[model samples]
Target chain A: MHYIEVQKKDFNVGYEYQQLVKDNSSDGAVVFFVGRMREFNQGQKVSALTLEHYPGMTEKLLAKIEAEAQERWPLEDSLIIHRYGRMEPGEQIVLVVTASAHRKAAFEACEFLIDWLKTKAPFWKSEETAEGTKWVEAKASDDQAADKWSEK
Target chain B: MITVLFFASLKEQLGCNGISLSGAGINTINDIKQSLIADKPDWSKWLHKPNLLCAKNCEVVNGDCSVTSGDEVAFFPPVTGG
Candidate 1:
């Protein structure tokens, strides 16, 4: 099974982990990633963050990223859950789970999914800092990370 | 008509989220940008910034991307989410 979701409500990490593991008994490895809002970014002290996305495009691009992961790995299933709207520091913002028969495929796929999502996804973030609200800018390091996957 | 969307800093700078451009003579994303700049000369400074990113429909694309009558094209700053 493959699933993708973009929601404003918080999700349960344990429950999602169970859902990815329940039916796929044959898969011996399950790798998951959870991203949380940080209190400090780019020398600013962030108290909260508000996330925005292109409504129709966000879901479409997420599904495309998931499909790419499945094609690159020998996997049993994969899942992606990303949240939008206002979130405080330490709150969860994203989750990715990859289930595969072997450890290597699960590990690589999970990393690849997050790396691609960072640069490819349409989500934008604005942080409430000590000075004021500031829009987050994309970093060159992220693009470099995603570029590594294209290498032979 | 072609729908244009703005996001993040671009939305704040543009002072609007979206606009509909009649497809009469426009054929590409760059054409839409030129029309918008022509209407509001004040926007020329940022509208043509080298770092600005765009998308055709929901896919990330370049300024030369073609557009149809009903396509939803987006203009925004580089993606910052993970």
Candidate 2:
């Protein structure tokens, strides 16, 4: 199953997360990754960040990745939440959770979901700094993380 | 005619997200993209870069692929974040 939201309100992702795992009673393991907005990027002090997405295409892309993870790793349930508009420092930007029959499938699939999402989903991050605003570019590490899975 | 769409940085640089162009000989998505870039040299940054990809008819499309009239051709940067 799939759950997705892109909004400005603060989210109780924990409850929604538990619901995903609970809905699939057979699931034995649940794994999640929360992306937080940090205060710094490339030596620049960021007070806030704005995330923008291509609405329909963004949802479509994420759903596709979630489906791929399920097919590759036997995940029973999955939830993905991504926030848009302006977000302050330390705010939660995104969450990826997966539940499966075994710990390995849950963990690997959850990791794979986030990894692929980083490179394949159509969301852009821009920094709001005292100096000015600038869109964030993809990091080499992020590409490496996603590439490793495709290679395997 | 073909509707050529842009997104994010591509839109920012082009100052517009979309345009409708004459598509007489443009039987392929790549042809439409080439026509747009050829008309607006300023968009060279986006068209020539390897980071940019084309979406034909709402799906990621290869550069060599063809498209019929009225197809929507979207150009996007390499995706980042979930």
Candidate 3:
């Protein structure tokens, strides 16, 4: 099963994450990832970050991503949450959790969700820094991460 | 009239979020792009970004798909946040 939500509050991704693994004693492994804002980027001090997203498309695309991960692995459950609006450094922005009967599938699928979410979702980020406010630029690394999934 | 929209980077780059256009035989995305190019040449470089997507009423679409007069067309760059 897949669950996805986009919100603006801090969530215990670990808490809901534990809930996904419940009632499935067969699952031997679960992997979770939380992405937080950083204090520095491209040699600059970051103060805050504002995330812009299409409300409807954001949830739909993420759900599709979770579904793809489930198809590739014997995943018991997957959850992805992305928070928007203004966020400060060291605050959580995204969380992904994957559960499976084995470690490899759980870990790999978790990584895959983060990878694809970066390049395929509908979110944009702008950073507020000491020098001035600027939008974060997309990186070549993100494309490579998303591309790896297609090679499967 | 069809509502032509741009989001995120595209909106900032183009300096406009969206605009109204009179839809006609200009049904496909290609037609809209052609008109936009004629109206604003600066966006030419971004038309072919590897991750750009065109959508009609929030559904992913191709450049040649027919767009009705009252449709909503959106353009956006690749999303890079996780």
Candidate 4:
């Protein structure tokens, strides 16, 4: 099974995990990653974050990324859920889960999914701070992380 | 007509969400951008950003990619999602 979602509301991680593992006994390893809104960034205290995305393109690119992951790994299942709109600090922002028969495949695939999502998915973030609302800049570190995968 | 859309800071900077332009004499994504810049010279600053991204009909494409009537084109900055 492969699931991808772009939603405005919060998701229940436990429920999503159960959905990924239910009746799937073949996979011995499961890896999941959760990304959260941070309270501070760039030496400033962030009070809120507003996520924006290209409605039609966001879903298309996410599904493409998930498909690419499946092709590269011997995977049993995977799930990706990302949220948008205004969210406070500590709120859940994204989830990625991968299940495979071996720990290596599960772990690597989960990391690859996130790396690609960070740079390829068309979601932008605007953070609210003490001074004013500011758009979050894309980090060079993120580009480097994603680039490493293509080198392999 | 072709529909052009902008997002994120580019949208805020351009001060417009989307607009429709005549497909006549426009051959590629670059043409669409040039036309936009021509109409609102002030938009050149945002639209011409070095890392600006473009998409056609929901797929990423280069400025030289061919476009025609009824296609949805998008312009935005580099992605910051995770």
Candidate 5:
């Protein structure tokens, strides 16, 4: 099973993990990732953040990322959850879970999903900082991270 | 007509979330961008920024990609979400 969602409601990580591994007795490992809003970024104190996305495009690209991960790994199941709208520091922003028959595949696929999601997804973020609210630009480091997976 | 969308800083800077352009002579993403600049001269700076990204029909695409009527095109600053 593969699950992907975008919503304003906060998610329960434990509940999501449970759902990821349920009814998959053959899977021996489950790796999940949760991304949270940071209090500081690029030398600025971030008090809050607002995330926006191209609604139809965001879901479509996420599903494509999940499909790519499934093809690259022996994944039994995977789930992706991303939140939008206003949020404060320490709040959950995104979650990714990958279940597989072994720990390595589960771990690698989980990381892959996050890496691809960073550069491929349509979501954009703006933070409330001490200076003022500003849009977050894509980082070169993120592109490098995603590029690593492309190396044959 | 081809639908165009903007997000994040571009959305705020352009002062519009989206717009529609006639498909005629709007074969490439760059063509539509030029048309936008012609109509809204004030948006030239942000619209022409080096980091601007484009997508056609929900798929990330280059400026040279073809666009047609009924297509949904989007332009935004490079993504920053996780």
Candidate 6:
């Protein structure tokens, strides 16, 4: 099973995890990750962040990324829930869950999913800082992180 | 006509979200860019950025990709989502 969601409303991680594991006894290992908004970025104090995305394209690319992960690993199930719109510091921004019969596949696939989503997804962030609002730039480190997966 | 869309900072920089252009001579994504720059000389800097990304009908594509009437083309910067 695979699920992909892009919405403005926040998601409940516990509820999503239960849904992922429900009636699925075959998978022995499950791994999940949650990304949150932080208060500081690039040495500036950020009060809130507004996320914007290409509506139709965002969902399509996310599905493609999840399918790519399934092709590369023996995944029993996976879930990707990413939130957009205005959010305050410490709020959950994204969630990734992966389940497999073995720990290695579960762990690696979970990491791979998030890594690819970071660079491939069509979402941009603008931060509201003490000084003013600023658009977040794509980090080279993030591109490098996503690129590493292609080598393996 | 073809629809040209811009996202995030590009939209703000261009002060426009989308526009429609007659498909007459618009053959490729680059052609659209050229047309846009011709109309608004100030947009050349942002539209011609080296790292600017392009997509056709919601799928990322090269700027040289073929385009035709009724296609939706998008231009944006590198993604920063996770």
RMSD of each: 1.0, 1.9, 2.3, 0.8, 1.1, 0.8
How high is the lDDT of residue A29 in model 1? 91
Tens-place lDDT per residue, model 2, A7-68, is 76767766886677554678788888888988988898999988877767777888888878
Please list all clashing residue pairs in model 3, or write none if there are none.
B27-B67
Off by over 4 Å in 2: A21-24
Q: Regarding lDDT, does 4 or 5 come out ahead?
A: 4
DockQ-derived CAPRI band for the predicted complex in model 1? high
Best by lDDT: 6
- DockQ, computed on Cα atoms, for candidate 2: 0.68
Indicate the TM-score of model 3: 0.88
DockQ for the candidate 5 complex? Answer: 0.91
What interface RMSD does candidate 4 have?
A: 0.6
lDDT of 1 at B27: 85
Candidate 6 residue pairs in backbone clash: none
At residue A72, candidate 2 shows an lDDT of 88
Q: Model 2, A8: alpha-carbon shift in Å?
A: 4.1
True contacts kept of each: 0.90, 0.67, 0.69, 0.88, 0.92, 0.88
TM-score of each: 0.97, 0.91, 0.88, 0.98, 0.97, 0.98
lDDT of 4 at A59: 88
Cα error, candidate 6, residue A29 (Å) = 0.7
lDDT by residue for model 5 over A1-152, one digit each (tens)? 89899999999998886766566688899887999999989888999999999899999999999999989999998999999999999999999999899999999999999999999899999999888898887899999999999874
Which rank order by lDDT, best down to worst? 6, 4, 5, 1, 3, 2
iRMS of every model, one decimal?
0.7, 1.4, 1.3, 0.6, 0.6, 0.6
| Tens digit of per-residue lDDT, candidate 2, span B1-82 | 7788887777787899789877877877677767877888887777778888778766787888888777878887776665
Q: Model 6, stretches more than 4 Å misplaced?
A: none
lDDT of 5 at A150: 87
State residue A115's C-alpha deviation in candidate 4, in Å.
Answer: 0.5
TM-score between model 5 and native? 0.97
Candidate 5 chain A: worst-modelled 10 consecutive residues by lDDT = A15-24
Q: What is the DockQ of each candidate?
A: 0.89, 0.68, 0.68, 0.91, 0.91, 0.90
- In candidate 4, stretches whose alpha carbon ends up further than 4 angstroms from where it belongs are none
